[model samples]
Target: MSKFRKKGKKSQPAVNTAALPDIVFMLLFFFMVTTVMRETSLKVVNKIPSATEVAKLEKKSLVSYIYIGKPIAALEDAFGSAPRIQLNDAFASKEDILLFVENEKLDRSEQERNKITWSLKVDKNTKMGIVTDVKQELRKADALKLNYSSKATDNIAN
Candidate 1:
């Protein structure tokens, strides 16, 4: 009998990845819950013109966007080439501005309602008539805090 027994080759223990799937699923669920997807799809050709001075909104959450532009090539057949007002995801007339403003106001708390800013994203080629009408409608809604969306530019005569 050999005095010293040969050492047995012990296989290394396999890594315990039993919780791997659970961890992956937990991460997936977390992203799904926290991810904020686009709420509205623009149906118009929004080409915001450049401006000499442009100021960014302080609180984006308190701002509601109104898109004004001609219909895109795809939508031209149905909506025509005329400029349209987009409230949320749908085309809205000036008449709808009042309701839209009211709805926006209702979405925010009473304390922050007054701070809500209505941003107008007017296309460059769009005429001023529609914009003026929108402004008047906003006035009726009493949403006086208005902001015009424009790209910043360096050169300005003023």
Candidate 2:
């Protein structure tokens, strides 16, 4: 009787982790299929001024971009130098800008005009005089919605 009872089989966990790799692979595949792609490709390079509180803009808003500095010179002259603002460009002149804005606003119905939003995406190196002039021009146009950006990026905030 002692010899028969002398040894007993040791208990061990029967569950094996051999299937863990397959389970992980399946879960990864499921997530990969369900993931959604987001928009990309808007790259702005400029020093963004700091703000105390940031406000989010609604998805539905009209944004007009303005590059204050000069346009890039010819390819030969474009060796790591800041480009000048091309006044020939739209919004380059205060009058042209105001006219363009007024025209665009006129095209919209009164209801739309009431909700019209004007955003200024000026470059960081923009001259104070130019920015002030632009502001004055916008005011002359009676544009109520004004959003001026000091950053070089695509962020448009109040």
Candidate 3:
């Protein structure tokens, strides 16, 4: 009967974290859907040549990139300033072209193999001789479909 009598059992308040995990998962999926990861780290500099007339490629999955450019500052001492071929992430000789094409073809489905296109990302300053050699090697490997990656040019006159 005193002022401080025995009190009834008190309910403890708790933080409701039931939806926290769901929210975290949703954010993770949103980032995954929006992000585009680079397939390979380019070892060479690629300042693509410009062109007036150009076609945009529709299916990126069917395209394989062949980078041709002068060695970047870091690689200048080892590879020199001359333009060179890069397959995947490393510097490659023209002799390795056929084998590279064959290996890339093996990664596609049988029906899609014939549709694979080689996209040449050549530097503007690169000599035509190296580009021509790459084309010849690609032909030897039966990779007939080709695309030259270039920037759009405002100048219409050649």
Candidate 4:
């Protein structure tokens, strides 16, 4: 027999996968820390009206949402069926907007205050009168930058 005769079929070395679990855990933790979830839970039902021309907000930090809709079933027993304005998580009247805007501005850096845009997420079925009142209040508050949040429409006529 030759000196290099078959050494009983030499077995292949296995790959060391001890670091795989650590790598997977690191990736999971990275996504968990980096992802941003919605901060506010909406109390009102919002069926946004569709629009042909819809622009996405660039800086979400510079935008504050004003939800205008009829109160949910639970809140209806307390607030009635009238369209209400939701500032943050609470129901607010037109008069509350001034103070709300001022307070919101105070929370931001002075340089960013001017760039703040108020996004109105008004329900499709809500009355124009309520919307007009909200607009008037925004004007008085000098929070002139306004954005009407609406769903995107493929139809040009919409």
Per-residue CA lDDT of model 1 for 1-158, tens digit only, reads 34334334555689999999999999999999988798989998899887787887988789899999998899999989999999999999999999999999999999999999899999989999999999999998899988889889897544
Best by TM-score: 4
- TM-scores, all candidates, are 0.76, 0.51, 0.79, 0.83
Candidate 4, 27: how far from true, in Å?
Answer: 3.2
Residue pairs clashing, model 3: none
User: Candidate 4, which segments miss by more than 4 Å at Cα?
Assistant: 1-17, 156-158
Query: How many clashes does each candidate structure show, in the order listed?
Result: 0, 6, 0, 0
lDDT of 4 by residue, 1-158 (tens): 55446654666689999999999999999999989898777878799988888998999899999999999888899889999999997999899999999999998999999999999999989989999999999999889999999888898573
Candidate 3 lDDT over residue span 30-114, tens digit each: 9999887998888788998788899889988899999999999998999899889999988999999999999999999999999
Better of 2 and 4 by lDDT: 4
Candidate 1: give its CA RMSD in angstroms. Answer: 5.6
Badly placed stretches (over 4 Å) of model 3 are 1-28, 156-158
Off by over 4 Å in 2: 1-52, 73-91, 150-158
Q: Higher lDDT: candidate 1 or 2? A: 1
Those runs of model 1 whose alpha carbons end farther than 4 Å from true positions after fitting are: 1-36, 156-158
Q: Looking at model 1, report the run of 10 residues with the lowest lDDT sum.
A: 1-10
lDDT of each: 0.91, 0.55, 0.91, 0.91
Model 4: lDDT of residue 116 = 97
Q: Tell me the deviation in Å of residue 135 in model 1.
A: 0.2
